[model samples]
Target: MDNLVKKVKEGIWSGRTDHLENKESFRYHQIVELAQLDTLDTEGKACVIIGFESDEGVRRNKGQIGAAKAPNELRSELAKLPWHVSSEKYVVDIGTIDCTGNDLEKAQQQLGDVVNQVLTKKMTPIILGGGHETAYGHYLGVRNYIGKAAKLGIINIDAHFDLRPYDEQPSSGTMFRQILEQDENSSYFVLGIQRYGNTQALFDKADELGVIYICEEDMHGEQLVQVNKAIEEFFQNNDFIMLTLCTDVLNAAFAPGVSASSPFGLSPNTVRSIIRIVSSNEKTLSFDISEVNPLLDENNRTVKLGAYLVNEAITSFLN
Candidate 1:
């Protein structure tokens, strides 16, 4: 753990510190506990924030590379949000795992170890990511905690199938294919897939892998009822579920700071509903948000939006 994660800097959590004793006056920075992974206490009813600071996978996949900066930027934005959960529940930041010198594989393994430890402490892991590759490490931790016999369902809110082949090397685009082909106990259900976002070969791969998915165009209004039904069925089938969001799944108009922009992606509200539903479920074990690039953002729009969405998940999990 020492080789992988560095404790978050104190300055990263700074924000308005009003009425130190009043719960109502609290902002996230005021209430969040900062701890080193090794010294963390045995605490339950808490959500631990782990940052995956790596974009090597995105670079390998031939996409923009600024997602490495997302973890702290998202933290800065989250620092100002009002704290609404009960006082007994906690939010803890355990710092970040950096992908130094293109060692994404090592960083990912390190992330998996930290995540496993967080779960072992009986806390929910809310991972802020470097790229969509974060899902694989997050998956590694969850599967480690639950054991091989337990069925794990991965609920990804994204525009691409991410089932691309990784024969040469694993990139951000090949995580799901790696998991489905390697772990029979794990299953995947993706929402907000775009018709043009993936190649026909990827679609065929998704089918071959028996993936359950809902296209972006069919995720709104009356159609949400059926979507909810599918989500419920997925929850019932798996022993545990892990939720991941790739910001690129949102319409480029709403989220422009991602590796891949989706002009016809799902709206923020639509994505929020799915996060709320999945995070609130008892079967759900962890949550991760990926591909938020501050370097490409419009006046921090995507970073702030990502923070709000993360708040939604944390609030739902604690409440």
Candidate 2:
């Protein structure tokens, strides 16, 4: 626990520093700080940001590795975003659970611990991820907080099912499968699954696990109504809902910085709409965005999209 909270130093060029008119015109860098999670009082309502800095999951999965550095990049970009919900909700920056020495499992365990703590405090936990593997850690925390019997609904916006078998060990591609295997009561839903991105074995695994998914091609072209209905039904049935987004689910044109870029994945607007839908539902417990590789990004497009999505989701929840 002592090593869990790594303080967030103000990033370079944090918010536009030149503005002086409203004095009240605010930005995230101005409000965010490294704070002790358990010590803060949100009165049962706050948004807690936690960073998951581990690429061992990616390495194990045999993907790119620079995503371990994504937490800080995400923070730097997020720091400049404008915030207008100070009165409605308090956004707490609870440092980061860095995978020091590249220890993925320990970092994940710590992430679960902090998430459980934040939930106990009755606050929402939003995780900035190192890779798709962050989903398992995020789920571990949610499960610890809510318990195994709770009906948990998982929504993944991605190009692939990420349900690959982890016979040897879990990776960025196997976390969802791990969750389902561990918890029978949990239900999983995925949007924007590219047909070409997944193999027959993965699709078979998803079907065997009873995972619900909409292919990228079907997510549009008159199938949108069914998509909305599916999401609504899932929300209604679950006791708590968790949303995880992997940037690789987006087309390379929009999200080229992911470990595995998609040639034809969902658009940002489509992804944002799904987030808003789930977020508006009060049962949505937590959200995490993953697989954003800033090292490979095009002018920080993936990072900025991530920041934009986070902003939109938080704004939706606050309102």
Candidate 3:
């Protein structure tokens, strides 16, 4: 586990110090425990934070290459938020799975191993990702924890279907396709799909695979009622749910620091509502936030927004 994960640095959690002895004034940095994978132990409900430090998948998919730096950047932003979780619940940071050179597959497998360990201990894993490819490893861990017989429903909030073929190699765009083709117990439901973001062939592939999707345009105004109904139905059908958020699913104006920017993507409020709805569910196993490219951000706007969204998930899970 040590070889697979590099422990988080203490400095990354530093922030405003306000009454460290008082729980009422505590912030995330003041309460987050740093632990090692081999020695992790918790007596109460806990959420473990793990980072995937690689953009190899994005690079392979012919996208930008700077998402590798997102994990720590997000950590820095998250350190300052107010900690509102119950006293019985805890949050721990166990560090990251580093992808050296071009060994993306190995890194992803390492992430899966760590995630499996976290879940085995009865803790929720809040994964900060290198790319959308992080979903494959996230899925692997959840599937392993639950075994092969349980039905796993994946809820992706993204603008693209990401159903591209991976004949030669697996990339960020090929994760869902790989899962659907190989895992019969798994099902997929995507929200905020942009009509112009994906090619016609991809749409045909989604149809052939029997994917459940809602267009981005149909998710606004009063149309959300029908969307919520579909979400509820999806939850009822699957035995377990795993939620993944691709930062690019948000409008580029609000989230410019992603590998694939969506000009007509969902608003932050809408995305937050979905995160709350999904993460708070008793059957949802874990959550991952991917594709936040700090290198492309303007004045740390996107990173801050990503941190807030992650906080929303943590609060929902812990409450």
TM-score per prediction, in order, is 0.98, 0.95, 0.99
Candidate 3 — what's its lDDT? 0.93
* lDDT values, one for every candidate: 0.93, 0.84, 0.93
Q: What does candidate 3's lDDT look like per residue over 179-270, in tens digits?
A: 99999999999999999999999999999998999999999989988998999999999999999999999999999999889789899999
The whole-model C-alpha lDDT of candidate 1 against the native structure comes to 0.93
lDDT of 1 by residue, 1-319 (tens): 6557888977899898879899989999998999877777775699999999989999999999999999999999999999999999989999998888988888888888999999998899999999999999999899999999999999999999999989999999999999999999989999999999999999999999999999999998999999999999999999999999999999999999998998899899999999999999998989999999999999899999999999999999999
Clash pairs (backbone) in predicted model 1: none
Clashing pairs in 2: 159-249
The superposed Cα distance between candidate 3 and the true structure at residue 216, in angstroms, equals 0.9
Candidate 2 ranges beyond 4 A from true positions: 18-24
Worst 10 residues of 1 by lDDT: 1-10
C-alpha lDDT of residue 109 in model 3: 85
TM-score of 3: 0.99
- What TM-score would you give candidate 1 relative to the actual structure? 0.98
| Residue pairs of candidate 3 with colliding backbone atoms | none
Cα displacement (angstroms), candidate 3, residue 211, comes to 0.7
